[model samples]
Structures are given as structure tokens and as C-alpha cells.
Target: MKKVLSIVLALAMCLSLAACAQNPKESTEPSDSVKPTEEAGIYTPGTYTATARGHEDGVQVTVTVDANSITDVTLDVSKETESIGGAAADKLKSQIMDAQSAEIDGVSGATETSNAVKMALQDCLNQAMGVSSDEKTPVADGTYSGTAPSFGLTSQMTCEVTFEGGKMTDIQVTEESDSATGEWFASAQELFIPRVLESQSLAVDAITGATTSSNGIRNCVAAAIDAAGGDSSQWYTEIPKKTDTVKLEGYDVIVVGMGGSGVLSYCAAAEQGATVFGIEAAGKIGGDSVCTYGPMAINSQYLKDLYNNGEDYINADDVYNTWMEYVGSDEKADVIHEAVYNSGSALDYYVDNFGFEFEGMGLLGSFVVPEWTKLWCVYSADDDNTSWNILGPNKTFQFTRALETANAMNEKNEYMTELTATSLIFDDDGKVIGVNAQYYDGTTYEIYGKTVILATGGFLGNDDMMNEYLGSTVSTIGDTVNDGTGIQMGISAGGATYMMGTLPMVHISQVPHLIRTDDLTADQKAILTALALTTDQKMITTEGNVWGNENQSGTEDEGITVEIVYAPDYMYYVVYSQEDIDNIRTNGLTEAQANATSQFLSQGGTLPAAGTPVEDIDQILQVGEEYQNVIKADSIADLAAAIGCDESNLTEALGGVDTTYYAVICDSYAYATVGGLDVDVNMNVLREDGTPIENLFAVGQDSEGVCNADGKAYTPWGGQAQSWTFVSGQIAGTQAAAVAAAAE
Candidate 1:
């Protein structure tokens, strides 16, 4: 009887619609039986509310329908991320109202939020239509395939999904090309795929730091679900409770962090017959140390071998003097001597004990004193792609060595990852005892040890700490995991801080020039085009000073560092001629430009054909022809007008470029920071009164005084910092173990 009634109602609605279409003018007239407040239609006039899950939380929506059409839609998006998900809700609400339908295009970069809105609207519409809430119409169980648009040069991300009993049974994402070298995609897949299969929903939270790749997988899965005709409302999954607990206890020494210093400390303690444990806040072990290219060493067997082979080698005395100069004369000579003298022995210990090897030695210096290359160090392993070697010159090679050391000591040492050390546990006497840690799943644990080593690295990842210590104008391009938790713990335990005013490694404008060409105007782009055609020109400041290679400067030296002069208005140019352009076309870009261009290309960014031997200059010119910053003009006055600069300034700065073309350049960026806990030569943390804290030690970036040897933190040479990481770790580890043994 109910089915018959539904059929009759449906027929009546169709007749009403036909009548309205036939007499549009009459339909607009007020009907006596219909309420004056409502539009003329067959829909039941009422308001309906529905809720749907979103990326981070839930979205509730209310809809008002007047007979035939939706009159209004209100969204409650209190649970969404303020910037991204909140903006999506605001924009999508207007779009849905304008279209007068629940189905609408999603906002780019906010796909999860947009889908939540759509699902909420669908629920409201179904309620208004008097659809049975429990109506279970199963989609045909089958395999479905779909693809999402690529982010870059990579292929469109494709997915194959299998449905069983109207539920998602399995999903397989194809190995597609990714400009991030598959890291982001791999992380997203590892985190998102399992959740999608369990909850059968595409509204899962995006991966914390890999949102782009997470969205790609979500879009692909949504496409497959649409193909399978699956009902999205039924795909909701219950969120799990966080009740998992892990307890660990009774160790002689506990090292907080599994970075270069942490791993070395653990190994050293274990070698001394002391039971040691290590913990890392990140899911993986390697911290910022994994990202280092190489370490600094002085008077090592590697350097001796190089010297014996008649290669340029630095003397120990020169290295010591240069370091002292870099640190300033008033710096602690004893600390400096300790690090310099033991650096070679530390390297030897690691090589002899862990089978670590050095490929060769190299130099790094500051731009203020370009001639002094006091920083020299051994690189690990060969650059050649060969068999699976434990260490290499690659930035991540140290991580490999650390992981190997951890594995080798698995019998005697225990380690846990994804556990954050929140605070230090102290006895009644104010002596350091252990740490208070919390797991990723909300479970807390108290880990105790006789001696505690703080190898938690620097606070580069904490923007508040960086702004407070390094100044607000400073920026960072370092590891995101070094949040200074260990430093905070040390300070809470009455440890003094040191070297808080050091200069972090910084460079100007490392991003590819052409990547931002979309912000340029046609005239400016044309200048860049002409400049790309030129060759054999070095990048220089407007004052004709060398702008490149500013890394060779001495400590605290004031000059035009690359980072200081990388402003867009500073206006740099590559002075070149048509003949140089022809030569470049025949021989390709200079080695420096080629290397830079190659790095940009590897990241899936487009570049001008200026580096290639092409006959048509149009192709090269067209590369950044749309960017406004690449200003070009036939005359100095026109060029000034294009760049919005004074003609006199332009004329004076670029006098020789009247018959030639010049291309504007910007800064390159790279960053690392120093400054941490105050420590003695034994790596024992010290109080504000200069008394050593009992059983407390700091190493690696956690030890603040390492880079402050000369009173200035802005030391030339990357090797000094790298070498200190290892040397401090060895010192802290050995001393910490001895302290633990003495206590026993």
C-alpha cells in the first residue's frame, strides 16, 4: 500500500511540473492553497540538518527548502582548519547556493572539506525527499579504476579499487613518477591507504607534512569510488581510541634522540659495558644529522693519506689558529683545543670500530675572507653509484651509518622511536635522573637511568625559539624535527644556556629563477629571454662586486653577504653580448649555471632552452617571457620604467650594459642553526653558576658552546660544525658512561 501511494505521489509531481512548464506566467501567480511564504512547488516545505566528517573533524549543515527549490544553506565549520578548510567551507557554500544543487565542483587545495559539504547537503536533501534512512541499496561489486591529474612532470596518479558486498575491499595505487622522488608519495601511501580500506572513506585527515600527496591519493580514490557507484554516506568509519601503552625501565644511561650524537652516545656507552637506551621523537631514527653532506676532521689519517699523495693538505696548527680566529680571541681556548685535538681520534675510533671509511677531503670557507679555506674534512664513501655501501658522500649517508650502528648494538642497547621526551625527572637533591616521555598514541611513560645524555639537537624547527633567539627576520631551511624539547628539559632542570646568538647557515634565493616567472610581465620576461641568450657572464651585485661564493667570509665580518643583497629591487644582471649568446648556444651554459639549472630540472621545474644548443632564440626567450621581474628594454630609461626603478640609478649601475643585455637574479637559500645547552669539556651540562649538573650531559647541536669558539657564531666552513657533532658525541658518550659507572 505504501509503494502504491509513493507511485501516485510521483505521478502527481510529474503532472505538476508539466503544468508549470506549460503555463509559466500562471505558475508565477499566487495559489490559494499554497502558502504565500513558500515558492509554488510540490516539495514539502521545511528545514533539515545533516552532519558529515571532514579532514580534521565534522561539518554540520542546515538547509531550508521552499516547496521545489533550496532557499538557504548554513554551514557550521568550527572543527576545520581556519585557513584551508574554513576557506573551502565559505566558498563552497556560495557555490552550492548559486547552483541550487548538492553536486558541485570542489575547491582546489580543499578537496576534503568540499566533499564533506557535499555529503552533508546530500543528507539534508534525502531527509527532505522523505527517503528511508535505512535504505540499503548495494552497488554492484566489481573492480574500478580511475586517475587524478598530476602535480608536475609526473604521470597522472592512477588507482585500482576492488569492491565486495558494496564495501571497498582493496585499493592499489600505481607507482607513478613524482618530482619529489617518490618520498612524499610513499609517505602518503603508507599513512593513508590503510585508513581508507578500514573506514572506506575519503574524508580521512591528510598526512601531517605531505598534504599534496595525500590529496592526490584521496582524489584518485574518490574517482574510483564514483566509478563503482558506491554510496559515500555508508563509507564512514569509527575513529579508534588512543589507549596503547609502552613501558620501559632500568638502564644505566638514557640518550634522548637518535640523531648522530644520540646514536654515537648509545654505541659508546654500550661498548663500555653499560646498558644504554635511546629514544627518538620522530617515527624514524635519523634526525637532522641524516641530512648532512659530510663531517669536518682535522689531522686525520684521511688527510695524512692525501698529504702523502701530494694533495693540498691543511696543517693542524693552521686549522687551530683559524678556528680560534673564527671564534674570537676571548673564546675558551681549552674547549677549542679539546675539539680540534680529538676530532681526528674520534674519526679514527668510528672508522676502526664501526668500519666507517672516508672517500676524500675538501674545503669550505666564508665569503668575508674568501682566500682562507681553513675548514677541511673527509667525505664518506664514493660518489659513484655502486654496491650497497654503508656510508657515502650523500647528505643522508650519516643517517645510514647511525642506523647501522644502532642495529649492530641491538643485543646490548634498546631503542624506541616515536616517543617524545617531554621533561627531565630529578631527585630531591636536584640531580638529573631520567626523562618523562609521551608516546604518539597518548600513552605516557617514565624512563629512568643513572645518567642522561641530551642529544636532542638544536631548536631550528621551533619558529618561536628561532624568532626569540635568532631574530624575527631570520628564516630557516633545516630539519623540521628539532623542536628543542631536550633544551627545554635541560633548562627546566637548571642547566644554563650558551651561544644563543650564533648565525645559522643561510644563503639567498635557492629556488629556481624561472619557477616564479608567472609573476612577471611580458616586457620584463623579454629582458630575461635576451639575457638567457648571453653567456660567459658572472652574477654580480649592482656595485660590480662578486655576488656569488659569499660563503668564504670569516667570523663576524661585515660585507655584502649573498643573503643581505638578494632583494628583488637590488636588480642583478648577467652582462653579455650576442656573440656570447652564440657561443653559449654552441657550447651550452657555463658549468655553474648548468649545475644550478640541472638541480632545478631535477625538481621537475621548467627552464629556458638557453643552456641548450638551439638555433631559434625564441624558445629560450619564451621561457620566462611572462615574468614581470625579468625586465627588458632597448634603452636604459625603458628598462628603468619596466623595472619601476630610477633611470639615473639604472644608468649609473649598468653603464656598460647599454650595448648588451642583462638578466636579473635573486638569492639562493640553505640553512642550519647552532646554540644550545652550556656544557663543560667532559660534555656535562653546567648550571648558571658554572657548576656541573650531576649525571647530565649534552652533545651535537644541543651543546651551545661548540660553534662559539671565537665568540662569533658565524664561522666559515661547514666542516667545523659537522666535525663538532661527532667529536662532542664521542666526548659526551665516554664521559657519561664513566659517570654512570662511578655512580654504580
Candidate 2:
């Protein structure tokens, strides 16, 4: 019986083992050697965040996960360029969340931002999964070369980079075709390369006033690093070395800047037998004046002669009252009076001394009076009608002639180009005696004089000043030379500044050359083409507001002023159709419109011919389809989508016009600006206490209490600011010369 029981037990155990082997689910105990697949959804549920180096700074990201799937993703991209890297982050976040994985394709135009997002996501996933962060792949240390496309010129910039111990050591521009490009690169490199080496990352602050060159350098360095297989790490940045200073003395008058006022002041002082010295920040002489049309004079000999010959004449008192009412201030009435009375003489000086000639009187506004038209003293060249035309008809003729005269005068008086005035030197008696300047070679100089003229123009080039004063990011369309250095110096030397928080000389048209055809994408081309087509259209802020022909009435100024003040966000839109285009082509656009059309054609855009019927509107359609700020929609709802406004609101604003196509326009360009250091009737820089700062004078846009006294309106065609440049400069120069002569 015992033997039989043992045999049965052995058979039962064998059967059980076979059954367990056949059906794995039947097994009760778990196997320790087996591994789970990724599909098992093994992850801790929580939110995790990480930061990675990006194009211009750190890109921080947060990721939320539920079990194994990504629930949400957010990014902190304040440091990224809004147009490029910021757009990338927005797109990449959606893609990563949808994919629920870190592995994803990068944004086409924003590769650095894409990589940064990927790395940050990987780190967050590693944290959430309780896994160690993967180390960056090490790169071999060696020298590498790369090149970046040019911006202003027709050539590329080549850069040589050296690496030490898998880290970037040095970066240098080996070849650059354009001299201006080379200088911009050098300026950008001074700030960018050192920061890259210290941070061990491509992210760095772009050099101010040289963003394109700075980005070029960064891209070139990035390419070289990729070629040499380099990775980023945290490192220390080094401080830049300072340049040495030199002292120069023995001048009666020192004029800072070489703009309209600066040149005029120098000439006026030299004529008074004062030893004058001129300092210019740029290589050239003309400042913002080189971009102007002509000057305004209330009672010039030319205008008086026309009036005597039975032409309509404007009363000086009427002009004065109009200006005073416009500026909303009679506090500087004496200064205004002087400008109105002496403006003609100042123009006479330029015409008699520099061979300047007036082509014809130009009507500044839609006003029909011959007197108002006579205010615009258009200059003429000897041979070429286009010689004076830089951006507009007869715009730069006066300035060009002034530049020639200034150069000739420089042969007798001392003048230094590329020497930027840094500060005013004051004596124990609180009088400005000289100026401190810095040359492009990094060497500083102390220039002594009995009198100093602050003609540094407006501060549009300085972003900090603009933000502090203008309350918004205003685009500068003129030359980038007016940096407000003289204004700052005057303030530091006990002078006062005024009317800073005011509207600049804003223009209706888009910034010239902002869109280049060769570099434009299809969407960009379409939007720009639409903009070009609507350039000459009569723009209206609200529906039902009609503007007549260019010379319809004297109400154009009032209309434009009201439009600018009432337009939302200081923006307006142009309304037109195929019919308007045909009309414009038939009647022919004004000189300004023709110039804009010519410019558009030069940028590789096409225009419809006269009497042409509506054909392809693809380019026009593309504007609403692509751009966020612009709109080109057939319905109000679609237009609202493009402009980010309520459909009802937009429809109401458009006066219930829901069928026609519409495009919004805003203040796209800033030509110049007014308001800087406060000045008296004599153009002498004044202190906050209303006392004149002896031996220091401010002129042109550098002097306050001139143009835009009301701080909201501007006289577009009267050459108000240009006229002030001549009148104020004459007064300041004459006063400065007198002071120097008395001292001698």
C-alpha cells in the first residue's frame, strides 16, 4: 500500500508541473527575471520642469503627465526672439503634447529653439520617470570654420572658431566683403563672443543697434560648433577692457554732431571769427537733416516777392497764432516768434552762401491757399532734378548742398568725423567749457572750448530712451545716428529735458526696404505686395469718412490729426478696390505715390495696369491667410480672426460693411522726432530752474520748445522741424560765437 501511494504522488506532481508550463496565467507566483515593455504605462504622475540653453537665453519648460501619457506642456520663453524662437516654442509645445513624446521634428526656421524644447522635455521626462538624466554627447575639440549670409551687402561673412578641451575658446571673423558689415561684426563680436565663451552656450544678449550683425555672428559660431561637434555648459563671462583717454584744447567753439543744426552752427560761429571745431559720431557729416525735403519760412524774401507779385500771402501773425494754438503753449512764444521772423534770413544765408536754389513752392497739406503752399521751399539742383531726391522729390537737395558747403568749411575750421561726444565739461562756475568724446578706434579725447553746441538730434536710436519716453516700441525709419547723446550730456551738465513722452514724426507708409524679395517667403511676398498696392490709397480710420483728392481742401491737416488721435492703438486702415487701382493708374499717382510704386517694383512686386479688370487676387488673399497683424478677409468674422478683434466690434467699426475685402494699417515707420534738451529764445540750453546753462546751446531736434510744442501734432510738409533746425541753429551759433568773442 505504501509503494502504490508514493507512485501516485509522483505522477500528480509531474502533471502539475506540466500544466503550469502549458498555461503561464495559471501560475500564482510572479517571475522576478521578466521585464515590462514601455507600453505598460509605467510612470509617476506629476509635473516636472527643466531649463535648456536656447538661441538667446535659457528656455524653461514644464511638463505634466498622468501615468504614462503627457497631459500638458508649458514654456517660459521671455528671452527668445518673438518672431522666430517664440513662434517655435508655441508650435513645438503643441506638437510634443500631441505626440506624448520628446522625440519630435524641429521647427524649420527655429532649429535652436526646437532643440532647446526637446532637451528641456527630455529632462522633465527623466525627472518624472525617476530616471537619471542622460548626459550630453561629448564633442572633439578643434578649430572650425563657418559662414553666414550677408544682410546689407552681396557677400557672406566667414568666421573661424577655436575650441579647447571640447569648449569654445575664441571666435574671429576671418573674411567679410563689406567694410560696413565688417565694422558691425566687430562691434557685435566685442559683446557676443566673450559671452558665448563664458556661458559655454550660444545664448547671449544681442549687441544693441547691430542685431543683424550680432545674429550673423551667433549663427556662424553655432555652425562652427556643430561642425566641430561641440556642446554647451555653464561658464563665467569676462569683462571688456577700457580704452585710454586723450585731451585736446584751444578752441573757441566746439560743436557736437554734424547734423543740420551742427553744420549751421559751425558755419555761423566761424563767420563770427570764432575758432570752431566740429565732432561727428558717424563717418559722414549730415544728420537727420540729410533725409529732409526743405525748410519752412513765414516771411522769406522768395515768398514776399511772390506776394508782392500779387500771389496770395499768409500773415505772420496768423501763422504764429496757428502754431501757438497747435502747440497749446505760449510759454515759448518768444522762441516761436524768433523762428518765424528769422527763418527767411536763415534760408537766405544758405541760398546766398551755398548756392542753394528753390525749385517751387510745395503745398504742405491739403490746404489750397497759395501762402500755405509757399511755406514749403522746395530746393532745386543745377542739372539733375533727381539729384536732390534721396527718398522723395527734392527731399535731400538742401542737405546735399549743405554737406558740400560743410566739407569746404572743414578745410578752414577743424572737424573730426567718427568722434562721438560723450559729455560736457563744466567749470567751477557751473559753465560748460568743453566736451569729452570717443573715437571709433576706442580712444577717448577731452576737447576744450569756450562754447559748446549740443546738436546731437533726437534719441530715436536709443531703445531705452524710446521705451522710457514713448511708452511703446516705436520703429525708426530714418538714419540710426540720432542717439540722444547730446541730450543726456546736457542733462548731466545741469540742463533740462522736456516733451520726451510725445508722438514722433510718424509716417503712414511702411518702412522702406523692410521686405527684401530675394529673402522673402511666399507668405511674406504676398503680404508685402498687398501693402505695396495699398500704399497710395486714401486711408480712413472709420467707415463713412471720406477723403477727397490730394488738394481737395485745407481740412487734410485736421483730418489727419483727428485720425491719428482717434485711431485705435494709433492704427488706421486703407480701403480700396480694383476700381481705385484703375483710377490711380489712369490719373497717375502723386510723386510720393509714384515713388512708392517704383520702390515696390524695385522690390520685385507687380502692379495692375490702367483700366485693368479684377483678375488674380491670390497675393491679396495670402495676406489674411498668413499674417497675424494684417487682415484681408471677405467677411467680418474672418477679418476679426486676422486682427484678433471681436467680429461685431470690427463690423461696427467698418460701418457694417461685411462683404468687401479690408486690410488694417498702423503706424509703420518713424521718420524723425522732436523734443530734447530745453532751450530758450537764443537756443541756449536751460536748466530745470529755467536758468540758461552758459556757453552751452541746443539746436535742431536736440532743442525742445521748437516743433510739436503741443506734443501731439506735427506739420508734415511745412518743414517745421527743418525750419527750426536752421533758425535755432543760427541763434545758438550767433550767441555761442558772441560769448567766445567776449571771453577772448
Candidate 3:
């Protein structure tokens, strides 16, 4: 009797294991279509919970099952992006319950969080079905493709992953958006792909300046892993970091940050015969400077003779006086003089010595005071420069070429990327010496030198610093690696800051969380950009008050007082009625569509002709609604409710809406903070009492404020920031080399 019982029990166990081996389904039908509990019996009556990795941390799901039915479902997606992922939680839960299984349609814009929720919910259902949860589901050997959002809202990064012997052997980016900067994306793909393959894990740190790209790769891989019958949560094993120290001594000058300014500094010091060492936090060399048009030059003789009839583009003396007047005082007259008069010579020095190139001289005139002397020129972006984009020309290769020349000049002149400088090293008597840095792979470095140059860009990437100093946080188009490390190091060495509250460089404006340019066809982008940029109709703030006529979205201004800068959070909504939408789809866009349209949108395609109907306007609006960028309603009160504004305020703003209405979101973007460490004309870091730190220097955005004033926008002349990189870099590099030579 005992033997017979044992055989029966063993057979039952085998059947259970076989059932668990079958692939789990997310959902097959909507909740309303699911059969009643008595007709479709699958689960044991109980509650189960599971968690999976999400955009931030983990998404949790608790599923309550009755015998043959899913009774209730709850989720915690708070760790995801509030506007995108978090907002999709309720819809995801409803779909799971309705299907009475794990399979369901995912929310459109929240792919990452939706996947996590589905994975977690499926695990819960598996648990309630009496399956073992100790080990992960085995991944089948196959190649799979998946996609997730990249930098642009409309664009997604598609990845193809191959699995063999239950291991991810190969991964490749099959499709990506052009809206993402080429340099940053290349850096992300180079470093992140290898790390993921070696560890076979998703818990890797994002590339410092290419975080969105790194996350896009990770999320898309997770989707592929799910498709291959693997438990993605199991592959999220964390990577370990080393905690060891390495030291080096005897360098003449150490430059922190290998951006435009730092590269120039390295070149200047190397030409002066100094053994220079450079440390950059990002995977590439150029920082925000690569994304700029060009520098301001008052009288660059090389440019004058090349572009003009051997005459300076603008008067240097006149510029000096105008700049002084704009700043309101001569508190730092010598530094302003160098910024004005030395600007042309600095441009010449780089062209002659460093292999830098510039072409096309003309106007990048200030928007603040339109008549304030046009002094800027554009960098050369010939056919060989494939990195050029509509936002800015590709000058990153020029920096790379200059660095190559500097490296050739001196064997000891070297720079390391993926290495971040943390603090300044000092001697016993308190003179700045070198820098303490850490490699991305967790190696510590204590590099010693006779002099140090702080050129780590500015604090735009640091949220805490931006909020504390600039009064509020703003969107940035520059590299996110400029987190004020250099400025903090300067303060650690008793250096003072100047004009820390000065306005950031705001230039472009677009729809908030814009659809990636590559995701849409040319015609779609044109129609969308036209609708978002149009201010001809009534525009309203978040509070539902009518916008001022002069508050055009792209027009630059001082402070946040006027223009799109004045909009709360630098965002507003353009209101349109059903008649307008009908006219757009029927008669075509009117002249009103051209009023405030962005020239940058030309990258997409030309705006449709006035009074020519756009055949796809309705489809375009549907896509906009899916991304939560467009809100539509049948009544004014309903529209107000969708926008989270008082009905009365909206009614007043729109003059009592009588038809269906739509609101399109618009936002302004900035480059970086212009304020930084105080420095003299020689680019020497200054103490609070107005004395220079003997062996220390500052350059680029790290000390560009000497040319501007607090409580105002950066010297509105376009490319002024890039010009400072050239001017201050030459001064600091040569001055630091002199100091090192004197010490030796």
C-alpha cells in the first residue's frame, strides 16, 4: 500500500512541473470580455505579490485571485517618470484584470513601466496557480527585437538581441533618432553594450552624460529578454565596483574636464613644453561647446582676410565700450577688456597653433538688445563633418583633431575619458597642486602636478546647484556632465564665485517632451511643429490667463519677465477650436500658422502652404493626444478640467468656448549656466578678498561671468560663452604653464 501511494504522488509532482514549464501569457482579452469565474477556472483562491525593475527602482504589483477569476489588482509604479510611466499604472492594472491573464495591450508612452508591471503581475498569477517561484523561467535560444523611448519623446531606440545557450551573446542598435547628439549616443553604445554583455545584467550605471541613451539600451534589452521566454527581473543582477587606489606624480599641469576649454588648455600647455594630464567625466572630449554655432570675434585678422575684404567684422574698441556699459560698472574692467580685445587674437592663436577651423563671418546678434553689435561667426561644417545638425554645426571633430595634435607634440601629454575629477589636491602650505579623480570602473587616482586648471564647464547639470543658485530648475540641451565639480573644487581651495545668479543661455523653444524627429515622417513633423509653435490664436498660461502678444516662444529676453521665458516652468498651451482643426484638415493652415513657427523645424520639412489642406492633420493630432502633449474636449469646462485649470479662468481666456477645443504644449530650452568661479584677466582663480590663487586657474564657463553681471542674462551677444572658452583657455593654459616653469 505504501509503494502504490508513493508512485501516485510522484506522478502528480511530474504533472505540476510540466504545467509550470509552459510559457505564461500576459492577457488575451479586455476585462469586460473575460468569462465569469465559474466558466473559466484556472487559479486557486488567494493573493500574491511580485516586483520587477522599472525606470527608477522597482514596480510592484499585488494581484488578488478568486478560484477561476482575477478579483482585484493594485500596482506601485511611483518609481517611474511621473508624467509617463506613473500615469499609466491604473490603465495597466485594469487591462490585467480584464484579460483574466497577464497578456494585455500596454500604455503607449509608458513601455518600460508597463513591461515591469506586466512581468510582476504574471509572476503573481503564476504564484496563485501553485507554480514554484524560486528559479527564473529559462530563456529560449533565439534573436528578438524590442524598442523603448530614447532622448526624444517620439523616437524610440530599437535593439536586436541574440540569445544562445541561455546567454545574451550579441546586442545591436537597429534604429535610433537623429535628435540625440551623435557624440553622446556613440559613447553610450561603446561603453554600455560591453558592460551588459560581460555581466549579463541590467544593473549597470548609466553613462554620465548619455543617461537617456544608456537607459534606452537597457529597457529595450529587457523587452527582448521577455520575448525570449526569460524572466527579465532575474537578469537585473548588480555589477560590483573596485575600491582600490592609484597615484601618479610629476606632471607640470593638470586640467580637469576635457571639454572645449580643457582641450584648448591642454593644447596651449603642451605647446609650451609642459607635461599635461587631462581628466574628463564623460566618454567624449567636447562638452556643450560642440553644440554651439561659433565664437564671437571682434577683429580676427585671419577671418577678416579670409571672409571679408581684409577688414574686421566689428570694431573692437566699440565692443569694449558697449560691453562695459551693458554690465553697468567697471568692477572687472581688465577682464572685460581681455574678453573684448583679446577675443580676436585668441581665435587667431587657436587657428594658427591648434588645428581648429572657422568659416562664414556675420551676425549672431543679441536678442536682448537687438542692435548690440553682431560679433559671432560659425565653425566650418563641410561635407566631411557628418556630425552637423540643424541645432548646431559639428565642431567636436575639430576639438578631437586639436587634441590629436597636442598628443603628438608631447608623449606625456595624455587625457583619460570616463574619469571624473572630485577635488583639488593641495600642498602642506595650502597651495593648489593637482586633482583627485576616479575612473568609471572604480579606480581611484591621486595625480599630482605643479599647477591645476579648473575648466569643468558649469553647474547646469547639477539640479541642487541650479535650484540653489539660479532660483529654479530649467531644461538643458548641453552635456549633463558639467555638474560644477570644478567650481566646488575652487571653493574648497578658498576661491570666490561671481554672478552665480546670472541667467542661463536660452536659445531654442519647442513642444515639451517633443516627439523625436526621426520617429515621424517629414509631413507629420511639419504639421506638428506648426501647431505647437503657432501663437496666432489665443495662448494661455498654466493658470488659464491669456498670454501677452510679445511673449513669442523663441524670442530671447533678460530674466523670465517676457517672451516664452516668462511662462511658468517656461511652458504654455496654444488653444485651438474645432473650427480651426477642421480648417487645418479641410482648407489647410492659414497665414496664422506662420506667425511664430520655429526656423529649426525646417529640419523636419517645410510648413504646409497657407489655405492648403493637410490630409493627415487628424492622424497627427491623434499621435499628439497619445503622448499627452495634446488635450481635447467637447466643452470649455471639460477642456479646463483636462488641463487642471479653473473653468472660469479658462472660459475668460478663451471667451467661452462653443465647440471642441485642443491645447498644445510648448516649452523653451537652455544650454547652461553662465556664472562660475571668479577669475582675473589672467584666468587665475580669485579669493574672496580679491587676491589670486597663485597656482590655480579657471577657464570656460567655469569663469565666464567676469564679462557679465548678476541679475541679468549672459552677455546676450550669441556665442559669447563659446568665445570665453577660447579666450580664457589660452590665458589660463599659458599662465599655468608659466607658474609651473617658475616652480621648477
How well is each residue in 521-605 modelled by candidate 1, as lDDT tens digits? 3333333433432234654444444434442334235443443323222234554444555666676555444434321213333
- After the best TM-score superposition of candidate 3, give how far the Cα of residue 369 lies from its true spot, in angstroms: 8.4
lDDT by residue (tens digit), candidate 2, 275-343: 788998765566666555567866677655654463434566777777676677777789878777778
Best model number under TM-score? 3
lDDT of 1: 0.59
Question: Candidate 1: misplaced stretches above 4 Å?
Answer: 1-238, 302-312, 362-412, 473-478, 511-602, 609-668, 709-714
**Per-residue error (Å), model 2, residue 179:** 16
Clashes of each: 26, 1, 8
User: Candidate 3, TM-score vs. the true structure?
Assistant: 0.80
lDDT assessment of candidate 2:
0.60
Cα lDDT, model 1, residue 640: 59
Error of 3 at 280 (Å): 1.4
* 1 or 2, greater by TM-score: 1
Per-candidate Cα lDDT values, in order, are 0.59, 0.60, 0.75
Error of 2 at 64 (Å): 22
